[model samples]
Every structure is written in C-alpha cells, then in structure tokens.
Target: MNAVDSALCEAFAPSGVLRVSINFGNPVLATRGTNGEPQGISVDLATELARRMDLPLRFVTFDAAGKSVAAVAAGDADFGFFAFDPVRGKEIAFTRPYLLIEGSYLVRSESHIQTNDDVDRSGVRLAVGTGSAYDLFLTRELKHAEIVRGSTSPEVVNTFLRDGLDVAAGVTQQLLADAKRLGGLRLLRGNFMVIRQAMGVAKSRGDEVATWLDCFVSEMVRTGVLRRAVARHQIGAMSAPEVKP
Candidate 1:
C-alpha cells in the first residue's frame, strides 16, 4: 500500500488499532463467524481499511445502527458502519455510501399485505428499531399506522412477533433472516426505501478523512474487494453501490 498522510493516520487510528464500530444486526452487512469472530461484508471491508492503513484492527460491536452512530458521534470509535440518515448528520459526518440495501416491511404470512404499498394503513401497528433509519423514515411517512419502537434493529422482528404487529419495518436483509428463522413471516414484494450504507466519523473530524474514506470505499468497490466480500457474506439481493463521484 502507498504511504498515507501521518496526520490522517493519527486522526483515524490514534490508538494503534483502527477502532471501527460495527452493527451486527444487519445480516447483509455483518454476522458472527463459526468461531464467534465478527464476520461479514462490513467486517471484511473494515479489515481491508486497516490493512491499507497498516493499522491493527479492533471492532467495537453493537446490536443497532443507532448505537454504532452514537459511538462515532461520541468519539468512542474512530468510525462506524451505518445507514446514512439526515438525523445523524447533526453530530457525525458520513462518507458516500459503498453499499445499498433495501428497506422493506415484514408481515405475518396470513396477512393481506402483499406489497410495500399495502402496509401503510389505518390501525396498522408497525414495529421498528428505535432511532434507526427505518424508524426515522416510517415516522415521517406512515400517516395512518402507529410506529412501535424496538430497542434495536434485530429486535424489531421479535417485537412484531410478540406484539402481533401489523407490519415490521426494517432492513430487507434483516426481515429476510427473520422470515427464514421464524415461521409464518413474509416480506412485502418490494422495498420501501434504499438504505445508503456508509462510514462515519464525528463531525468535528472535518472533511479531510471523510473525503479519504469516501475515496477508499470507492476504490474498494471499483477493485472488486467490496463485491467479493458481499458474495462471501452471502448477502443476497443486494449490490455494491456505484462509486460516488
């Protein structure tokens, strides 16, 4: 790898290890390995980022994107992988997305909700992860349905099951995993939103490293490293985003 700017290095991995907050809830992005190691597309990319920087790697795991974003905002981690959201823009700066995932709704198999459009109806109760991109989106868009909050993204499916929710809104991959693991759960045919998965740092870090991360992600995608990681993770029905201009 080419030498990196020393100042950027100090700013990004001050503790020697490139500390990256990773959300394990999004199955498309990350999951546990056979030996209980962190494993997935994001983990592979984070490892690659550290390797390129010649920094040791440390992953600070979280069950939710909100917690991962909070770690970035609080400067507890050098950076984190999360869905890009305007609400998070207040405290953190995110690079252009390296991946795109779909947001969809899950419902009981017996329900009449065959499409994404069928979910937003009166008396419908939707379970969503608190402070998540899906929650943020549904809060603003679902006029008739009541939004029920789960502590984390992975918990949304549980909440939906326990509460007999009319719909469960979250990452499509997450919904798919739940649908497969649990009986009588199915996803709406189409996605309700396209989630931009990006890396983030505290807003105070300024544009220099953010710009570098943006470029780093693009290079990873262009070089096929990211796409390969996605394939290894078995992330179905998704694609690495086009490099941001």
Candidate 2:
C-alpha cells in the first residue's frame, strides 16, 4: 500500500479524530439544508473519508471561500473541501486534484444571451459571488462583461433571477442544479476554463498530510470511486479534467 493508505490505517486506528473543513457554497462540496444540517457532495466525501479512516467527522461552515481557506490556515480545520486556487495555495498546501471542474455562465432561459458572443456585449452584466473562485476566474477571463459581485451564491443567483443582472457566472454543477429548481435558467454551451479541485490543509502542518491527501485523491480517481461519487450526486454532467492527459 502507499503512504496515504498507511496513514489512513494509522489515522483511523480506532482512536483518532480527523477534523475536515467544508464549504456549503459548492453543492459538490458541502452545503446546508433548510434544517441547517450539512448536505451535498463534500459532506458525502468527508463522511466516506472518515469511514475509510475509521475516524469521526466534524464540519464547520463558512459564508465565504476566503473564510474557508482561513479556517484551514488557522488550524481550526485539519483540511478543507473546496475548489483549490493558486492564490489560496499560497496560504495553504493543496492535495493533488481529486476532481476537475469548469466555469459556466448562468442566465434566465428566456434571456437573449445564449452564446459566448452575447456575454461580451456591453449591456450584459455578470453576477458572481464575492471571493468565489468563479469571481476570480471571471475577473481574469471575462474582461468585457460588467461584474455584479454578491457576497453569496444564493444572493448572486437571486439577483440574476430578479433581472438585476443579465447573467451570472458560477461552477457548472451549481448552475445545473439550480436550473432544475428555477426552471427558467440555463448554463451556457461552453465553459470558461477548467480547474482542479483538491483538499487544502494548513501550511503549518508538514507536507506529510498534503502528500497523503494527494495519494488518497489519486487512489480514489484510479479506483473509480471518485467518478462513482460524482454520478451518485447527479453531478456527473459537469465538466471534469480529462483523465490525467
């Protein structure tokens, strides 16, 4: 077995507790329900990781992606389950990507903006959650679009739904799930760019932990567990990295 597998054997050895941090913003990661309990792909993955490690799982919620990164940096969380960005990487160490993702534009189904060219028009405003990876990507890539930044994804979505903006940019998975609920919004045909999703651990923690997480992630992908989990959550339709090539 690999070092990560060995670490798992030790970490879960009937007496360890692995505290992982998760964000509720990303459905593929963690999110809270109306009842205020944790739910979503991140929760599922954390639970599974705990099961494999035979350890207990604890969750802490944050309102922003930056705060989630802070939690890991402050040692309040052993690791974080969220999109890993290079900017945030400076604050914390990241595991090898366990999954891949693509950014997308979300707009009302009835909206006239249907293609990439449409989004570039002067009047088309793009809403995004402040400090989100999507916001970062949009600021960097969609230079021509006016950005209407919100503090949360729901706020951003609601603003767009109310016609406060012409379009909103977000993770393709979130847009897809929300589209089912709103019934009037649609994800654009293509993605802005692809990103890798990995776990973030405190930099103070030795690289051993990050190395183990990377191995665990690699194992999950190789064994098809990661793909299975994505399908189980009905998020398989979202774009993921082309298998290591």
Candidate 3:
C-alpha cells in the first residue's frame, strides 16, 4: 500500500520538492504554454502528483525525451515521461503505459513512397531524432534504409526536408504538423509503430519510486484525471488504453 504521507519522500520528493522532467519537444504530451511556461498533459499530471504527495513542484525542462531519460537516470531529475523501449529499460524502470502515440513516416509528396511498406527499401534514407524511441526501434528493425539522427526530436523534420531524405520518422502528430507547416510532404497511410508513453525513475533512484509511480499512473488512467488533462491541453485524441487490472 502506498502512503499519501511523505513517508517515501526521499524517493519522489527529494530536497522537499518534486522535480518533474518536462519534455517540451513531445508535442503530443507537452508544449510551451502561453506564459512561456511548460504546459501540457504531462505537466498537469506531474503537478497533480506533486500536490497529492504534499510536495512543491519544480519543472525541469528538456528538449528531448532521451535527454530527460538521461537526466532522470543520472539522478538530476526526479522522474520523466518516456516511451517504453527495451533499450531505455536497461537504464530506467518504467511504469505501465497510460497513453499511446502513433509513430509513422513522412515523405516528399512526389516521392515514390506511398505506404509504410515502401519505406524499407535499400536506398531509402530516414531522418530520426537521436536517442528517440523511434530511432531506437528503427535502428533495430530497419535492415536496409539508412537512418540519419538529428540532434533532437523537433529538429528531425527540418533535417529530413533539408537533407532530401526519403522519409522522416517520428511521432505521427509531429509528422502531421510538419506536413502542414513544411508543405510538399505527406504521412504514410499507416503507422510504423505505436509509442507507449509512461513515466520512469532511474534504477539508481531505488525501487520505491518505481512502485509508487506505477500505481499512481495506473490510477491516473483509471480515473478521469488523465483524460481531463488531455482535454485541457487539447492534446488530441491519440489513444488512452484502460489501465490493466
């Protein structure tokens, strides 16, 4: 049983404050608010979690989920939102995923690639965010297409367009936005993958936070809290699976 009290403060609320990693590049889950503060579904959830724990909330911003993962793993941030990937699993412990986002490819409108099946060819070049979940997945799955890693997620689309790459792979929402903004680009008919969004604490941070966060996330999904945040942030109807019993 988890205690509502700060009996486990050291694990989650170190320094009498809970520092939440805000991955602002993940447009589906986070973005900058009107006031230039971190504002999005993840921010709301993190804030509520801190409130419930009776701790002051502190925001630690990261431009990429990989950076946030590294920060949390290095014990620089208390916890962060991340996609559940085996590669990252080695370094951090993940809670059950509460949200899922589509991962797909975008290509030049005049390109021969019309579907997801066309993306794996020998000459295809895909641009991906270095250390992103899609990059890790494609690095393992893409046998022929070459992957070029940009410095971060938000830069991937520009890197793809600038380099004349065959495809840009990342969160589908980001791809859609790029297609709308950059023009001359379109998303493949189907998704290449589904990114499972979850929270993680560093393995070095101990098992207590992991256990507590797992329960907290499941509750957040089961109740309407997670849904409300999604609606409030206008994050779109990506996908929210019921928490496993």
Candidate 4:
C-alpha cells in the first residue's frame, strides 16, 4: 500500500485522529468482545485504515446503524461502515461496497407470510431497525405493510415477538440466529435485498477523501484484505467482488 498523502490524512482525520464508527447492531460485521470492546471485520478494517494513514485511532461505538451514520455525518467520527442507501448518501460519500449481506424476513412458523412478497400486504405489521438499509429501502418500496421501528437490528425479532408483528426484517445471519434461539420462527424463502456494506466518510469531507477511500476499498477487495477479515471473523457475509476504480 502507498503511503497516505498528507492532504488525504488531513481530510480524513481533521481532528488529528481517525475516529471510526463501529455499529454492533450488524452482527455480520461486528460483535461485542468479551471485554466489552468492539471486534470483528468492521473493527479490523477501521484499524487497518488508521494504521495505513498513521493516525491515532479512536472508536465511536453505537448499538444501531442510525447512530453510527449520525456520528459520521455529524463529524463525531471520521468514517464508518454502512449499507449503501441513497437516503444516507445525502450526508455520506461511500466507496464501492466491500461486502454483501443478505436482508431477509422472519415470521412465526404458523404465519401466512411464506414469501418475501407476502410481507407487503396491508394489515401485516413488519418490524425493522429504524434507519437501517432495509428500513430505508422497504419504506420506499413496500406499498401496504405498516413498518414498525425496532431500536436496533438485533432486537428486531424481539420487537416482532413482543408486539406480535407479522414479519421481522434484518440481516439474514441475525434472523437465522434469532430463529434458532427463539424457536417457532423461520425466515422467508429468499432475501428481500442485498445490503452493499461499504466504508464512508461524511460528505463534508470532500471528494478527495471520498476518492481515496474508494481506491483503498477497491485495493482491499483486490488484494484479499477484506476476504481475510471475513474469514478471520467467521462472519456470514461475502466479500464484494472487485470493481474497477
């Protein structure tokens, strides 16, 4: 990897430290360590980026993606991993995705919601993490279903069960774990969406910072940095295919 240009460092770490936002809500990218610290692919990527930039590293942790995105957009953090969403793009500039995570729906075993499309019917209340990629996407796409907001992705199933919602939507891995843990729940047959998870800095960081980040991610994909991170973490997500910059 090339030495990070001084200007690039200035742009990414304006406070003289690289503050990376880690969202533990997405189990496929991050999880709480035994010591209560953040760990997993997101942390590994953030650490690697800071090391390459030679900046002092700091973590701004959140339990939900919305809070993580807010921290980056509000300049409380320098960069964060996020699912690509046009709604969030208004405040963030993202690289090409480094990972693809499936989004699916979970339903009670006796529920009539047997397919992803069945989730869109009127009177069927669906629970989703507020401001999640799927939340933003389904809000726009689902014409009839009433969307209930879960406090966090990991809690969506709990919210669904608590309120007796017809469907619970979130990362497939998370839903699968929830299904196995709670019993009598099963995920729909197919994914409703593929979340393109990528690293992003606030749009206020300027195009130069965005370009550098994009190039860095493309290199990570090409050189297997992302693949190794996924393998090391043993997460369910797949590394995104390399894309020409």
TM-scores of all candidate predictions against the true structure? 0.93, 0.81, 0.95, 0.98
| lDDT, candidate 1, 1-245, per-residue tens | 24677888987777777899988877778888888788888788888888889898888988887888888888889988878888888888888787888998889989987887777888888899888888887788888888988568888888888888898888887788889998888888888998888878887887887878888877887787777777776787455667546
Candidate 3: how large is its RMSD? 1.5
- Measured with C-alpha atoms, the lDDT of residue 114 in candidate 2 is 79
| Per-candidate local distance difference test | 0.82, 0.72, 0.85, 0.91
lDDT of 2 by residue, 9-84 (tens): 4432223567767776666666677899887667766777777666777887887776788888877777786677
| Pairs in clash, predicted candidate 3 | none
Tell me each candidate's RMSD, in Å, in order: 1.7, 3.7, 1.5, 1.0
Where is model 1 poorest over a 10-residue stretch in terms of lDDT?
236-245
Summed over model 1, clashes come to 0
Model 4 TM:
0.98
Tens-place lDDT digits, model 3, residues 1-245: 36675567876767788898889777887888789898888888898888778888999998988898888888788899999999999989999988888898988889999889888889899999988999999999989899998658888889987888888888888888889997988888888998889988888777877888898898888887887877777766454677563
- Which one wins by lDDT: 1 or 4? 4
Q: Kindly report which residue pairs in candidate 4 clash with one another.
A: none
Off by over 4 Å in 3: none
CA lDDT, candidate 3, residue 199: 88
Quote model 1's TM-score. Answer: 0.93
For candidate 4, the lDDT comes to 0.91
Where model 4 places Cα greater than 4 Å from the true spot, the runs are none
Pairs clashing within candidate 1: none
How accurate locally is residue 229 in candidate 2, as Cα lDDT from 0 to 100?
Answer: 74
lDDT of 1 at 75: 82
